[model samples]
Target: MKHNRKLNIFLIIIIIVSIIPLTSCIKDNVQPISKTEYMLGTICTITVYDNKPESVIDKAFARIKEIENKMSVNKPGTELDAVADAAGKNFVKVSKDTFYVLKKGKYYSEQSSGAFDITVGPLVKLWGIGTDNARLPSQSEIDEKKSLINYKDLLLDEKDSKVMLKRQGMSLDLGGIAKGYSADEAARILKENGVKHAIVNLGGNILAINTNTNGKPWNIGVQDPFKTRGDPAGGLNVTNKTVVTSGIYERYFEKNGKKYHHILNPFTGYPMDNNLASVTLVTDVSIDADAMTKNIFYLGVDKGMDYVNKKNGLQAIFITKDKKVYVTDGLKGNFQITNSSFKLMDKK
Candidate 1:
């Protein structure tokens, strides 16, 4: 009996030693996670999950700060500030990133038939719709600025990597697409740092990399156009997709019962008076999604649908002045209309 007991004890020791290595290996192979949030003009959040240390989060935040410093028009002495200063003078040489963005803006301008123009800086500055100095500009002032608002004046030398505005008083404003570009850049940096799962939210431009912990799609809310801020319209569920919305309610000025929004029509040199109250676009590319939202908002329903249908892998939901919701066929199963007063109308 003593020898049998000894043999049983020896077997138990072997089993215990065998489990020790497996436990240690599991612990050593555990993934590291870090989340950082900073309020830069807009709320910016970067979440990183990998085997990297906490310092990686700081590096990522630093990269975001670099981009913001270069791109922010609100910041004095930035690259954007230089461009703004050169508004009516010689063309300013910008960073390659800025050049590339301006090229994309020009392409979108042509594609959207001038609906998406980066050269509307003059009008944007004039109206100051979102600022405390918001007001209506004179007809003569509007007409004069409209003359210089053509995107054709934007000269791009691809081989030399330079951008120039052919005419004086022409300016480039990336307000419509800068956040998306920044988010994409941030994602690239995180991926380079061995981050496989993350989300970068630069204000409304949200970019999700890889699947969530549960391997499910990210639930991104498209802000309700008619509803007040902080309310989601039951939103849409997106997977490997970017959702962006441009709405009149986002930035505007109301005077004498007249509402003037920040989104200006390049043709009329005034805020768009179309039936569209807001436009939300979903696509795989945040930059494209950002540009399309503005284009669709200005194009209104018929032309907007045509543009969306021509492009593959793009979907949109448009809210009209009457609170009517119109969505592309691709979004039939994904987008839900929450406002009862907002009826879903089929495009003919």
Candidate 2:
């Protein structure tokens, strides 16, 4: 039998704010080559402004599909699913790529003190937030899954390149970071193809390859969380950065007039209740930006700002439910407020 995943239960994938080329409407001297495909359960696009061959774009998407096949828990017989099926039994040796991602996932899970747990698969399945099975689980069910949700239980052997989930019921979901990793891989493929400039968008995990053909930074619109999708609260100028946002509005379900979002708290095993409407992370690595959105959201606005402020390369734009916005030091000069409704607040 085959497993058919409509929402993938563990798909942390969401279309956050997207990048908009400032001169997108203006015709360029040289036309850019682009391709869009539905992969990783999301629409992905690769646009190369260097007039690279269509084969290069195909290669990038092919790499993304390869990553999806290896890391996606939705697919049966995948390396990740095989490890999950054998959890608490024995170590399952995996490919170098899968092992590396698992190692990185564990690292972030530890850094966030289990707040961004990669082992939240059980909890995710219980709620089924984005799938046809979407429903509120009973208190006992939530507790049971929560008990199985522990990042510390995921063991990795570097020498053998094997992984083991300490509990039999535990599952691994890389949806949180897999898309970002894929976007990074796509960008690398374009760069390797000698394409000087491109934009890799893996369902809104935006990675700007290089500066624009005009030698200017790419303009990325930060979505107004309270407003429509294309509405921008502000814009960011960047050369080589990945932008990702996680918000309550991205995915949700309403039952009995109350809404349940997909961003589950590792501690409570429920939707996170916070003042933040959205948290957009700007970093050089797409995977970090993707995982950091959830990690920073776990910290809330104040502590999240403190964490990003101290980081050497990471910057954040936090929008609260009250419509207040705050940007880290690195983006203060590069980010411009374009909407009057959004008040840029001082980081305290």
Candidate 3:
């Protein structure tokens, strides 16, 4: 009788143990804290999942704002403006953050073979893309500005943490890479604060932290170049990764029925006519993905494919002007084409 009683008690204990996990999962719920602000020349969104409190999200945004204040070329009295003001004549000492970004900019400039030059600010101002003043530049004006666009002239001093532009008219614009660096910084801050699941979107550059509460990959949509905002050409299943896209559709102006995009070729001082509509990069590093979109888009498909194929852990999705999506072999299963209007090409 005692043996049977003990057996029944053991069975009850087993049942109790089985129910505990479900109850714990129900209790350990995730609350998403999201905040949006107008900064970095675009909308910045930071979302964090925490069961304890919502204060970490604020810190993350503050970090982003701090970066914007230091690096924004449009903002007067900024570190970038300081360097511009001191161009050719003097060296300007900047914050370590500024120095770091400038150094990375130089690295990408060399890697992309000047296809993505931070020193293209002169051209940017002359063309004035992404602003109310945007207009087509005269050939003479384009030629003059092209003379000022040289990444080789940007001198960075590691010893003194200073930067000097060799020419007086030269300017630095971190618009291409700063957003990604800010996103990565925000992620670092969140992780340091013990937050695991979060999403950081600076303008359209996205960094998905870890995974969702159920430990599933976060689905990020690739914007449709033909359609309006929020329309997805396809979807990328990502977790703990950064997804960045550079498309002609992002910033452009219509003039005489011709569209002029912001991504200019440093050689010609005009919008690049690479035939590809958009290039999307996916990687663990946000800054790398951010800068690569511009570089690879400038290279177009053939050279860009050759460049990306040699790199490790880097995947690309190229949407051509003919409504075709070319994905790298590594992203075969992870990328899904949702828009029927676009057809997926065979993997290269």
What does each candidate score in C-alpha RMSD?
A: 15.6, 4.2, 14.3
Q: Give me the runs in candidate 2 sitting further than 4 Å from their true place.
A: 1-18, 24-27
Q: Which candidate is the best by TM-score?
A: 2
Worst 10 residues of 1 by lDDT: 17-26
| TM accuracy, model 3 | 0.90
Ranking by TM-score: 2, 3, 1
Which pairs clash (backbone N, Cα, C closer than 3 Å) in model 3? none
What are the per-residue Cα lDDT tens digits for candidate 2 across 70-117? 998667789988888899999999998899888989999999998899
Error of 1 at 23 (Å): 33
Candidate 2 has its poorest 10 consecutive residues by lDDT at: 8-17
Q: Which ten contiguous residues of candidate 3 have the minimum total lDDT?
A: 18-27
Number of backbone-clashing residue pairs for each candidate, in the order shown? 0, 0, 0
**Residue 92 lDDT in candidate 1:** 72
Tens digits of lDDT, candidate 3, 21-63: 1111212556567766667876566767667466788888889
Error of 2 at 150 (Å): 0.8
